[model samples]
Target chain A: MTTVFKKTPVLTDTVMHYCPGCGHGIVHRLVAEVIEELGIQDRTIGFVPVGCAVFGYKYFAVDCVEAAHGRAPAAATGCKRVNPNNVVFTYQGDGDLASIGAAEIVHAAHRGEKITTIFINNAIYGMTGGQMAPTTLVGQKTTTSPYGRDPEHCGKPLRVAEMIATIEGAAYVERVSVDSVPNIIKAKAAIKKAFQCQLDGKGFALVEVLSSCPTNWGKSPAEAMDWIKSDMIPYYPLGVKKDRTNE
Target chain B: MVSKVTIDENRCKGCGLCVRACPKKIMQLSKTKLNEKGYHPAEVIDQGACIACASCARTCPDAVITVEKE
Candidate 1:
């Protein structure tokens, strides 16, 4: 029998703080696995934003900084600018990037900052009691929107990957998910490519991972996966949004 | 050539999607009670007839299903 796979070395032995069935832990492991595979854990630095994954410092065995709410890109910008040789990346949620830190993300992408950004869009705000976020699906109920999101009043979910890819400075952009094992593997590869783009001085790179908030979605872990396949994928649409690698 | 499907009860949420997604009709969710997470997980009744089609594993959200050759 052939060995399927093994855990990544860059990940610490500490158990993740995320809730059971949360997708953050899966994405975290993928990032760590990529870092270990590329042999860059020693020089890697991660910036954690204010969200469910704010405790990223505890999981990754490397230098990590807790950025101000939604200001991770700004902090990562400074870190990569000052220490150009170090591997710098920002882990941000939809609430952080699409809401509070929108300006920071746009500016960073516009300036072509040499950094990688991992964007987790689970639709609802997992932290702070499952409120409707900027990326929340229309007709999706949250603490703020009980009758499901309304386009006439609250506006539609922002497609961050497509929006960010339009920027001239962004060298690579992709949207993936952890709904299945095959997709999870593909997502890891996309994330690794984003990091490699930054390493090559290719400019701003972003990987938007469509995650699941099972607790907030009022569904079991299994239902959340089905929801992702039926609802999230249709709106977000997986694939490479932009790639300037050939350029 | 009977393959048995085993589920890690601790991780299952008893969502019943796998039971709904199964094509072989070999699995049914346990209606007897709940697990540690208070969710009713699916249990295999006729394990001897499983063909290892992987439908349950594919539909499972928690990655808790394990298939073994008996």
Candidate 2:
């Protein structure tokens, strides 16, 4: 029998610590698959952020570095600069990327660091007991925003993909989700492209994945997927926000 | 052509994504059995009905499903 689907070897045998149905597991698999398919596992380096995926290094078989909160991009930049021949990427969540690491990510992209970033924007902070993150939707209730996020007080959700796309050094930027089968395929393709951008010596590349935090959202895993389609998509439209590889 | 679906019971976290992704509705979580993790692992209700589209394997967050076709 021909195998239609199998787990990628780039992922270690370690069972992920992510919650059941958490988007982090799906994204983690896609990143591992990409690395395996590209045959870059031997020379790939991943920078894991301080969030729910803090144990990312344990899951991915490639060399990894744990960065300070919201400092994945900065650490990734240094890694890429030091090991110009190796593939470098960062796995970060909204709390780490859009909030604490905002300046770090922006500056990394602005400088056109040769690295890829897999940004998981689940709209709320998952690791910290579902606190409101910078990307939290207005009127969305979280532990910190009990009555729903108030735009007057929180301003609004930060569109990291669009914000990073505007920077000159960002060579490729796309926003995708894992709420459905087709979207999952597209998300994987976008992730591959982002990694490819870095492999080609192109500047910074980031793929913002609109993930789900079922535990924090206080919804069933299925309901969380629907919420991503019904609510999150409206605010953070999916598409390629920027691409300079063709230029 | 016949298709085969395998689920690593212990690895499954009972997310039910495969149950939802299966176009044939053959995938279902075991109601009477729980894995070592205490989660009801997913299983195929009717192996003959599986089309081997790998949709279940694709959507599985835990990567517990493996699809093969002959």
Residues A1-247, candidate 2: write the lDDT tens digits: 9999999999898998989999999999999999999999999999999999999999999999999999999988888888899999999999999988999999999999999999999999999899999999999999999999999988999999999999999999999999999999999999999999999998999999999999999998888999999999999999999999887
Residue pairs with clashing backbones, model 2: none
| TM-score, prediction 2 | 0.99
lDDT score at residue A149, model 2, on the 0-100 scale: 97
Q: What is the C-alpha RMSD of each candidate to the true structure, in Å?
A: 4.1, 0.6
Docking class of 1: incorrect
Best by TM-score: 2
Best by lDDT: 2
Best by DockQ: 2
Which residue window of length 10 is worst by lDDT in model 1 chain A?
A1-10
Query: Where is the poorest 10-residue window by lDDT in model 2 chain B?
Result: B15-24
Q: How well is each residue in A181-239 modelled by candidate 1, as lDDT tens digits?
A: 67877998999999899888999999999988888998876678779999999999999
True-contact fraction for model 2? Answer: 0.79
